[model samples]
Target: MEIKDLSGMRKDYVSEDFSEKSLLADPYLQFDKWFAEASLVEEFEANAMVLSTSGSDNRPSSRVVLLKKYSKDGFVFFTNYLSRKGREIDENPWCSLLFFWPHRVRQVRVEGVAEKIVYEDSLEYFKSRPVISQASSSLSLQSSILEDKERFDKMIESLVSSGEDIKMPPHWGGYIVKPERFEFWQGGTGRSHDRFRYDLEEDHSWRISRLYP
Candidate 1:
């Protein structure tokens, strides 16, 4: 395969404008507004976000994951608590979520602490998942070493044959990311991208300001 650097490829477009005042005083409201607008016009995974975490060793890591829910208080997503991301979260609760809607030339970055959802909350959402997914969760020991595909499939089949109630894996749970800061970016040509940042204060109020591109 030939490697071609597309970084130099530039596009010219005279389009949308974003500024400090263009956003709401409440960053959460502004996020909701942008989310709705993007959902209406963009075709890709609107709810997907790049989640970032730090391990016990303080090394940084990130991966794309679906955004499950959000509110004025926090954002919620589910995963196996024993997985890599989960272990990272357990060791260091702080995390960040990034959302990009390329078609709309917009991106949002959120930073916060991650906390486990209530057991009942986790149970409710777990039960709402597809039956097959529930079964997989029960059969899988997330982050555990496995021998091969044969062993994995056999475990799943054994669980299926038992025909017992598939209890929620104790290691499976949901985490809420209570955002302390949010940065909004709207792309512009010549690297003059529009950017705004909203930081939360101790009073639970937000301070919104425009940032250098």
Candidate 2:
């Protein structure tokens, strides 16, 4: 197989221009607006976001997670508490979430502190999941090394045959990121992108600023 070298890959962003004056005072509202637009696009997963977390060792890791919900409170996503990212969040609650919409040449970066949501909330979400998903989540040991596929299959088989209600694992739940900062980016032609950041103030008001890009 010949190795292909591709150094000339780029796309000129000609999407609608974003301006500071057009942004909402509240970052959450602004995010909602962008998300709603993204949702209307059939080709994109509007709720998918990259969650980045750091551990006590200061090593950072990121993974793609679905945004289950969002509001004035924060962005919510579910995961196994024993997962690598979960442990990292336990060690260091501060994290960042990045949402990239390449089709629209837009991105949203969020920095916040993550905390596990209440058990009742987790249970409600868990119950809404399909039975297969519930079974897999309950039986699977996330972020753990798997020696063989047989064991995993057997566990799922047993869970299915037992006909027991698949309950949420004690270590499985949702986490909400309480954002303190948000940066919205819109790609532009000539590599001159539009960037705006909203910082939460002590008085609970958001201060917006435009950045050179």
Candidate 3:
């Protein structure tokens, strides 16, 4: 085995300036603005975010999940309740969501508590997904070992060809993450980036502060 080093790789970030005065009083509103901007420039899934969760062992795990919905209430994404991330959220509700848009040289960090959304809400989204996707989710035992991916794929194909209506699995649902803190970062020239932190106060108001970057 040989150690590989590619420290020479680098790129400069050039984006519109961001400042405290331009910040929105509500973090959710601020997120909405940035999210909209990212949607315009991102060629791929702009709603994708990294969801990090930890269970009883204190070991952290992160995976990209698409942002299905969001509002002042929280951010929502769906997955199998029996999956590793879902199980972790059940054991420890605290979690974090990170959104990075390289095209915009911006990212947002969200620290929050995750809770399962109502079954009706989950069912609605589940039904809206494409039939193939519905079949896949219904069949997959996410995060579990797959000894035969070919067989699984065949099963999915057969299920779809059968024209059977796929029902949302009992273990599949959505989780809403209520953010307690948010940090918005904008990459700047010469690494003099801009960062701001928003924390929820006792009165349910958000306190915004700038961070040294």
Candidate 4:
């Protein structure tokens, strides 16, 4: 059988509502609650998110990455510093994070500037990773073009043969996206949606208000 078009096969929602009255004063707090709910649900890849970044020449690129942690400080994720995202962050620290939990019809968009963590912090996290991932961290020069696909495997094998502890590559690390603004969107039927946004105030507090969605 052949696959058919989905343009006329959209589904309707009969789930729940995200009301403005129930929202927390701080979007981060509300996000925490929703994230907790999503974590326990059977949603597909609950921690997966689309991270968008702008390059030095001003083009945009987005890819799915697993969110490692989130707190009042911001969202955190790890990446090879030599990857495309790393180069972009090195050029422009600003970026956006989009999280969608379709099972609950909830989504969140965060705009923030990223800052790299200190070596000590990166080291702690690096040590926590499984051995294979640590080996991969040393294999690829990240975004660099591969002359041969086997290079990485050979490199990993070499590292393993050397029988030494894997040290986190200098070009591998973590970044924290300290959110200045966050937009929460809950889906509604027939194009009607609910949106609430929270922005940081000058005094280190939060200002939240509803938005037309």
Candidate 5:
């Protein structure tokens, strides 16, 4: 196969404009409205989001994680506590989450502090997962080097065959991100996108502002 030139690749966004009047006074409610709309389409993983974190060394990393829940309080996702991202969050609680829905020509950026949810919550979600997923989560040590795939597979098989109740690993749980800032972006004609940012005020209200794009 010949390598193709990539310079010409581009798409012009000509979606409807997002205006302040259409925004909810509460940023959380605004997010819910957009998420609800995105959830209606079947093409993409509407709940998938890019979580970015920085450790004490100031080096940053990003990975895609599925958003399990969201509400006025915060956004929630699950992970192994000993994973790289988990360790990074331990060192620095502050992180950012990015969600992009190209089909809708929209994106949401969230900045916040992450805090672990109660263990009971994690257990509840774990129990709701498929048995195979439970086995994988129970057997695999996330972020650790695996020397043998066959061994891992055998372990999972053993767990499945044993017919024992699979429990949530002690190292696995959920984190809730309490957002302090949110930026909502909508693509527009001629590359002129509409952007709005909401910053939490001391008075517990959101101060919304528009940015040139």
Candidate 6:
């Protein structure tokens, strides 16, 4: 066995300064702009984000989930309501979302309260998914121990070939995270990063402040 300690490794980021004058007054709009840029520059799924949640035990869990939708209201992602993350959200609604774009040398953090969207809306999105996807979601017991991988794959294949219209399970739907705060970070040279935080105020307005990095 070999142990490696290459602490000297580093990646320098040289980019335009993200100043206040260039920032959008609305944090949502600023996120939109950066998201668009990331979409163009990122070679893979730009909407992939880290969803972090803490359960009743106060143990934090993090997983990468695709961002299916977003707006001024909040961000949306779907999953089995009975999954681990889903159960955690039920126990504690407070969660945070993180988006990192390495190629763009940027990242965004969001702290929010998650709530299930309307069932009808979830059904609508479910119906819009491809038949195979719908079948997979319908058959999958996410976050559960997979006793038989081959059996599970066959089950999904069988369902997809049955020619029956798969319905979204009652235990499966979407959740929208209503953000209370947002932070945007841009990488800088010499290990100096640019960071800004947007805090929700009593008047439903945002208080944007720059933070030391």
**Candidate 3 local lDDT, 28-141, one digit each (tens):** 999999999999999989999999999999999999999999998999999999999988998999999999999999999999999999999999999999999999999999
Candidate 4 per-residue C-alpha lDDT over 44-91 given as tens digits, one digit per residue, 9 for 90 to 100: 777898999987899999999878888888899889977899889889
Pairs in clash, predicted candidate 4: none
Order the numbered candidates by TM-score, best leading.
6, 3, 5, 2, 4, 1
Off by over 4 Å in 5: 1-5
How far residue 22's Cα lies from its native spot in candidate 1, in Å, is 1.7
lDDT of 2 by residue, 1-213 (tens): 998878788778886868966888889999999998878873868899999999999999999999999999999999999999999999999999999987788899999999999999999999999877888899878999989889888888888778888889999999999999999999988898999999999999999999998
In model 6, which regions exceed 4 Å deviation? none
lDDT of 2 at 142: 95
lDDT of 1 at 96: 93
lDDT by residue for model 1 (1-213), tens: 999889998776445777665768888988999999889988887999999999889999988888888998699998899988999998999999999998888999999999999999999988897766787887777778876879878777777677777789888989999999999998886668888899999998888888887
Ranking by lDDT: 3, 6, 5, 2, 1, 4
Steric clash count of candidate 2: 0
TM-score per prediction, in order, is: 0.90, 0.95, 0.97, 0.91, 0.96, 0.98
Q: Which portions of model 1 show Cα errors greater than 4 Å?
A: 1-3, 157-163
Cα displacement (Å) at residue 120, model 6: 1.1
Each model's number of backbone clashes?
A: 0, 0, 0, 0, 0, 0
| lDDT, candidates in the order shown | 0.88, 0.92, 0.95, 0.86, 0.93, 0.94
Candidate 1, clashing residue pairs? none
Could you say which candidate leads in TM-score?
6
RMSD of each: 2.0, 1.5, 1.1, 2.3, 1.5, 0.9
RMSD of 4: 2.3
- For 1-213, candidate 6 gives per-residue lDDT tens digits of 798988988888878579898888799999999999999989989999999999899999999999999999999999999999999999999999999999979999999999999999999999999999999999889999999999999999999999999989999999999999999999988878889999999999999999998
Local lDDT at 145 for model 4: 83
